[model samples]
Every structure is written in structure tokens, then in C-alpha cells.
Target: MTWQRPASVPVGQVWSRFKGRERDGQPAKMSNWERYIAQGVSLACFTETDGAPDELVAFNITLDLVDVFTLYGVDRYLTSSGLTVLPEHRGQNIGARLFEARKPLCAALGIQCTATVFTATASQVLASKCGYTQLAELSYSHMAARGVDLSGCATPTAKLMGTKFHFD
Candidate 1:
């Protein structure tokens, strides 16, 4: 399979499908969507066969951030977001293939790749398999905001952490 970043492809189609279902009660904010389109590039993986859209099994969004500077000599953090494989295409290692295609794109942009996964079992497994590490675990005060009970949980807030993969 080969992956290419085509400028004419409709990235919003895949992004809306994945993100709309993930976040409830709100359309993906248009401003954020625009920013993503401006700051990120979309990759599509396809088979060699002609007219084989079905073989176009995976999609990813890689965001480039060059405005922030850190001591590690890193200026960009490439985020891998909205990774989705067709339902019939699961268990085929397509996700890993899609990620492998992204490495060169990150290097070309001079960015350190990272992704954030919520406290979900599947996400944690996939992120770890993709070479991401757990940088920090965070807690939130849900009761104060959402007025919900989180007695058994350590904290109502979700975890937010950073992970890095270097291509050099």
C-alpha cells in the first residue's frame, strides 16, 4: 500500500464522521476545523489497484506546531488525530501501516510526533503500540462543574499528557 497527501481529498468527510460521533451535542467547532485544515495535512493510504476506493482503508491528520519552543530542541509537535479504519478493515494492521506512513511527513516538517488518548482501554493499547509513552496522569473536579458523583474515582478530571516519537 502507498500513502499520499493529496490536496484535493475531502478530509472533512472523514473528520466529521469520527469526531462528530466522539463528541456529543456539538458540531465540531468550525474554527477548530478550519485551523486543522490550515495547520495539518491529511494522508490517505491506497492500494495499487486502479479505481479501488475500498482499499483506501485508513486516514490520519498530522498537525504541525512550530510556535512553541522547548529545551529539548523541539519546535513542532505533530499530533496524530482522527485515525479511523473502515469497520470491515479492522484487525488487518492497517492502523500501524497508516502510522508508519506518517513518519516521513513529520520529519519533513521538522516536528516531534505526539498524540493524546483519553482514559479508554482501546486507545491506551493502540497509543502504546504506536510507541507513545505515558508522560503524566491528570485528575479533574467533575462535581464542581458537571455536578456528578465521582466518589470511587481518584479525580473527576480526565488525564492530559504528552508523548513523543523522534525520527532522527
Candidate 2:
């Protein structure tokens, strides 16, 4: 099923839910969720309501990425950073559907979409499966030197991926 985000959901509600959940035996930190929301990025969570016991299984957070676009000497680009799904709800295609929802959004906004897939995360596979082209691959050590923490990540490298519907 495609992603379904309720209009009434709140970030705090989801943050609480992810707090005690484990990804690779490491419980997801509430700080991560808070930082994602505090960045003032747009966020959406996927709710599986097609059957009984509807639930929030996944989420996607997008930013305008104006700064990055400027660095590239262009504009009209979006960057999606938080692509998360509950561990218990994974392998059900929730991540793919959430990622797919961005296609129409990009078309409507006339912007290209980009995101990153970290090693050992389902996002690496999900990004490819959702038709995002691999743009670059950077090792964790390189990212760490840039002041970004990679301790929690399981992958050796993080891949940047992109999808576009317009040339200009």
C-alpha cells in the first residue's frame, strides 16, 4: 500500500514510540528524533490503515536543501534525510512507499530529490529499490572527519542518491 499520513499526528508522539526501539540492538535515541524535527524540515509518517490495528510504520523528512543547491551552483532541489521505519514493521515495503511518495511532490514543486543511504541500514536497499540513482559513496571515516557521528551506523560507507524528473 502507498503511504498514508494522518493530518493530526504529532512529532512527539512518534518520538516517544521510537525511543525504546532497537535497530541493531541499539535503542534509537530520542535526541535523533528531536533533532530531525527541530531542523524545521517537513515530515510525514506512513500509517498502515488498510487493515485492522492501523499503525505508523515509517516516516520521511524533507528539507529544501537550498544551501546544498547553492553549493552545486543551482537551485530547485530537495534533500530527504530522515527515512525511518519501525524495526518491527520493516520488510513490509513501508520504506519504499514512503520514498515513492516524493515523486509527485517533486513534480509539483518542480524540484529534484536527493537523499543518503547509510551502510547496514535498510535505506541503502530501499533507495535503490525506489529508483534513486547512486550519486556518490563516502566512507564512514570521511564523514566522521567532517564532524558527523557514524558510531551508530552499521555501514562502512554512506551513499548519496538522487532522482529527477526535469533537466533544468
Evaluated against the true structure, the overall lDDT of model 2 is: 0.57
**At residue 140, what lDDT does model 1 achieve?**
45
For each candidate, the alpha-carbon lDDT, in order, equals: 0.50, 0.57
Q: 9-117, model 2: which lDDT tens digit per residue?
A: 3333322111222234422333345455453434445333353323444567775554454433456566766677767656656566666666655554456655554
lDDT of 1 by residue, 1-168 (tens): 233334554343222112112212321212233343454466554433353333344556565555453533565565656666655446666666666656656555445655453354455566668766666554445444566554554434444335555664
With candidate 2 superimposed using the best TM-score fit, by how many Å does residue 147's alpha carbon deviate from the native?
A: 3.8
lDDT winner among the candidates?
A: 2
Give model 2 RMSD, 1 decimal. 8.7
Q: CA lDDT of 158 in candidate 2? A: 83
Tell me how far the alpha carbon of residue 161 in candidate 1 is from the true structure, in angstroms, after superposition.
Answer: 6.0
